[model samples]
Target: MSRTPEAPSAPPVDGARTTDSTGPDLAAPARRSRLVAVDAARGLALIGMIAVHILPVYDPETFEPTLQWTLFGGRAAALFALLAGLSLAFSSGGRTPHRGRALTATRAGLVVRALLIASAGLAINQVMPSPAPALGILVYYGAFFLLAVPLLGLRRRTLAGGVVVFAVLGPVLVHVLGPVLPEAAAVNPTVGSVLADPGAALAQVLLTGTYPAVPYLSYLCAGLVLGRTDLHDVAVRVRITLVGTVLALGAWFAYWVLVLQAGGYAQLTQHTPWLSEDQINEILVWGPSRDLPTSTWWWLLTSGPHSNTPVTLIMDLGTGLAVLGLFLLVARPNWLWTTLGAMGGRTLTLYSAHLLALAMTVHYDRPALWFAVHVAVAAAFAVLWQRWCGQGPLERGITAAVRGTRRLVLGAPSRTAASPRS
Candidate 1:
């Protein structure tokens, strides 16, 4: 929103944000079909992810709470997935494309893009050691985009119904099909290293067993459905976010409680009623399966099983909604949305920056202080982007690459640089 650019786009790895519980009010996703809250969540998520990734850059051995592999670790990416879903639905041309036309063409284009992005993720992980990202969000997101188009045409109620049914039966679907999926195994680096060939990361991305595949698509589809809601008004957006924030968090806590309290309440009941009563809870219990018939808890927590998964549904979804509340509380201040929103807008660029930062991390011999500094720095860069340039550099690049070609066909001039004083 600021017409004037602030400073350079790089963060000093040595800088640190005191984790002030009191940052400015932020934007909510529902407000922007672009899903402002979702973007804010992603911006925050990626920042946290970068911090954790760089934490190794700062401190190679001692992991920070932000980087911990518990329920917390998984939260950021889930937010990314859900927002991807929302973006897919939001970006759809209001109506689903008929059997032909650009929609058909877009589908083909998306597949290619997905592979392209997945390849990039693989290359980054293969090169970097500590933050070796096995299950990249873009790979799964591409798969989700393919599924989302058709669902957009489904009646809203049908969409909602399907989401619930699939979620309920998620455990069963995974049980039968998960073994073949790559991401499931990639869920943990321990298993991922066996199959991961950074050189062949793209192939692994396509593997049925890869992370961000089936069950992950479910989250994207759900987001697409949510995006269908015409909550454009600030008031309506606030109300929906307020309600969703409550439900998502409530469900998350409830899931945690059920898992913990099941000690006496018909052990393995979460699985018994679904996966098979005879299925032993331990192996059956295997990490929090966000798959079919695994457990209701999966939907609340993540689209995947928990393996020291840091980011939980509560954090991803909650932070998104709460950030929105903060924005509304501040009467939708421009800077509030633009800053966090900048990361979302420049997702691919920032994503690449993150990888580049990680490469720097590995190259720097895993310094903890530098990593934290970058986390803060990445965010500061985002603010700079919003103020200096309106659209994200990465988003701009991808849009140009994808749309520029089309524009050339129409005899339109190609636009490369974004406005500095955007």
Candidate 2:
């Protein structure tokens, strides 16, 4: 979701009373500043995603999943979405939000940012070498931005309430209506698909794709609320961890009690002839099998990747929040955190490069080696690049375009350079 980190195009920062709870002094002039913890969290999520992509999750011999897959899988992308929301909050206004012309300029910047990210994602989809369509999150990220535009002005409390409602109801509504909606595009969306059947493409992006925007919006909204808080406050970080732990563990516990222990899976096994026992077992191990079967409503209780189920969304949200909280707590000016944050700050560029690398690699037989190589290369490039250039290439380009658009619309130059928020 932080695929395209877009900053506000130099909105006028009024000298309003700064709230200690919100951390930063918004009254200060706009400069290229970022929360290191947020970037570190994004970097960690990016690493997890790369591991999911390159490393073999399940053992070929034992058919048992690797620890990396078990830990990251859906959670990594969830973190990305959450961080994206946080970035949006900072860019829009941080604690003290913008009003009138400033708000309009911010909105225009977001629109431009979304268009750039979505276009890039579609272009990347064309060349991705994965046999199965890579559910690249870049396009979905654009949708997140577009949808979040309206919600930008809401107070933190309102955004928080929206998160609760969407987490519980969003996936449920998607499940109830998904069958009747237009069929989703295959694998990755393409420009041709967008041009030929715009309606279907919209449906896929909103309701039926791998990362359905409708349900995933909860993560974004929650991150927005968190961003409004003083991320620099130790108390705030602790609260985030506590709240996230509760949501995650509670969701998983409910799923276990209501589904497995309550005989939901058993009933599904007995009643569904289409899926064999082994197939069900595989789903339990791997996931809810991408887009889960529609034969039974019990699937809605599943907490699997791409299930788009209520529990899955809620659980992953918790996981993301917790990870972010931990990162914030540990985001000292240490070498380790700094190194990871460097990579995180440039996730858009690194993520694209990783996909390109995947497209070129013919053999994944030695997945661990490949994973190591990718991580090393990405980390090295990020560190070295940051030494010479503050921002990543793609990230800089996107930021420049958005800033230029903002300047044109607002009839003035922005006050700062591109602020990269992963």
What lDDT score belongs to each candidate, Candidate 1 first? 0.46, 0.76
Candidate 2: tens digits of C-alpha lDDT, residues 315-345: 9899988988887776765678777878888
lDDT of 1 at 299: 30
Q: For residues 301-364, what per-residue lDDT tens digits would candidate 1 score against the true structure?
A: 3322332111233334454444444443443335665667566566677666666564543435
**Clashing pairs for predicted structure model 2, backbone only:** none
Candidate 1, superposed: residue stretches over 4 Å from native: 1-38, 54-72, 94-102, 130-135, 180-210, 264-331, 360-368, 385-390, 404-422
Q: RMSD in angstroms, candidate 2?
A: 5.6
Off by over 4 Å in 2: 1-34, 413-422
